[model samples]
Target: MIVAFDFILLLFVIICAIAAISVKDLLSAVYILGAYSFFMCLLWAEMGAVDVAFTEASVSAGIGTVLLIAAVSKTKRRSKD
Candidate 1:
């Protein structure tokens, strides 16, 4: 059961990664990257790396996402294509 959950989590992470890269909108991509970071945190926690997971959550998913969004807000929101 745990392995199944891990497999699903990994699949979602891969999907989120692809979506983050493929999205044209900068803000949307940042949000998707944040989601990817969150999923990574979950994966780490599941693997017993609690410290790494918490760091990923607080730094990557939290402050990192906020900073990316703020940076995007200061620039153009759309892509040239």
Candidate 2:
């Protein structure tokens, strides 16, 4: 059951990463990247690295996501060449 949970988390992280990189909308991409980081934190916790997981969760899922959202809010959501 633990292994299954890890596998699912890993799969979600992979999908979120792909979406973050591939999305055209900047805000959506940033949100997806945040989601990816959250899953990574979960992965770290599952692997028994409590300290690293705590740091990752606080930084990536919390501060990082807030910063990214703030940045996105201050700029245009789409880029044009």
Candidate 3:
């Protein structure tokens, strides 16, 4: 069961990463990147790295997301040049 859960989480992380890269909308891509970080944190917890997971969740999913969003906000929603 634990292995199965890890597999699922891994799959979810991969999908989110792909979506983050392929999405045309900058905001949606950033949100997906944040989701990828959140899943990575969950995967870390499942692997018994609680402290690392905590840091990943707080830094990646929290601060990283905020910074990405702020950067995106400074640019146009769609690119023309």
Candidate 4:
């Protein structure tokens, strides 16, 4: 059961990573990267590294997301293609 849960989380992380890179919109990519960071935190917690997970959650998913969102918000939206 735990293995199955881990697999599902891993799948989500992979999807988020791909989506973050593939998305053209800066805001959307930042949001997806935040999701990816959250999934990584979960994966670390599930693997029994609570300390690492806490750091990932607090630093990456929390503050990092906010910073990225702010950066994206300050930029003018434009399509390259």
Candidate 5:
């Protein structure tokens, strides 16, 4: 049961990672990347790596995301299209 759930979570994380890369919009991509990082943290926690998961959550999903959003907000929102 847990294996199946972890597999599904991994799949979703992969999808989010791909979406984050392929999306045209920057903010959407950043948010999707954050979600991907969060899912990774979840997987780590599930695998009994609470320390690693906490670090990932605090850095990638927390501070990194905030930095990205701040940087994005300082620049133009739309692409040249």
Candidate 6:
């Protein structure tokens, strides 16, 4: 395993997690969470856990993202804040 690559992915995962939580927009947060999931998938794949990577890609980054986006779309765009 490449240490530098792992660190890069870990950094991205942390950034995405922070961005997802800090963003006020629901859709943007969902997208960021999806990115976080993707980065986690990459990390798992790099660590030789292809099954985990596939599951993360199919579940979190895939269906979870779609569902979250659809739910967000159903909400009012403008927030009271």
TM-score of each: 0.93, 0.84, 0.92, 0.88, 0.87, 0.89
Error of 4 at 9 (Å): 0.9
Worst 10 residues of 4 by lDDT: 72-81
lDDT of 5 by residue, 1-81 (tens): 279879988899889988988888889988998999999999999888999999999998999999999989999666643
| 2-62: candidate 2 lDDT, tens digit per residue | 8999999989988998888889899889888888988898899899998999999898788
Off by over 4 Å in 4: 79-81
Candidate 3 deviant stretches above 4 angstroms: 79-81
Span of ten consecutive residues with least summed lDDT in model 5:
72-81
What does the lDDT read for residue 48 in candidate 6? 96
For model 5, the local distance difference test gives 0.89
Cα displacement (Å) at residue 35, model 3 = 0.6
> TM-score of the candidate numbered 2?
0.84
Which pairs clash in the backbone of model 1? none
| Candidate 1 vs candidate 4, TM-score winner | 1
- Local error of candidate 4 at residue 77 (angstroms): 2.9
TM-score of 3: 0.92
**Most TM-score-accurate candidate:** 1
What is the overall TM-score of model 1 with all chains considered together? Answer: 0.93
Poorly placed runs, candidate 2 (over 4 Å): none
**Best candidate, lDDT:** 1
The residue pairs that clash in candidate 2, if any, are none
List the candidates ranked by TM-score, beginning with the highest: 1, 3, 6, 4, 5, 2
How many steric overlaps are in each model, in order? 0, 0, 0, 0, 0, 0
Clash count in backbone of candidate 2: 0
Model 3, residue 4: what's the lDDT?
95
Positional deviation of 36 in candidate 2, in angstroms?
0.8
Tens digit of lDDT per residue, candidate 4, span 1-81? Answer: 289989999999999999988888888888899889989999999999999999999999999999988887888644453
lDDT of 1 by residue, 1-81 (tens): 289889999999999999998899989999999999999999999999999999999999999999999999999999864
Prediction 1 global C-alpha lDDT: 0.94
Give a tens-digit lDDT track for model 3, residues 30-57: 8999999999999999999999999999
Candidate 2 global CA lDDT score: 0.87
lDDT of each: 0.94, 0.87, 0.90, 0.88, 0.89, 0.89
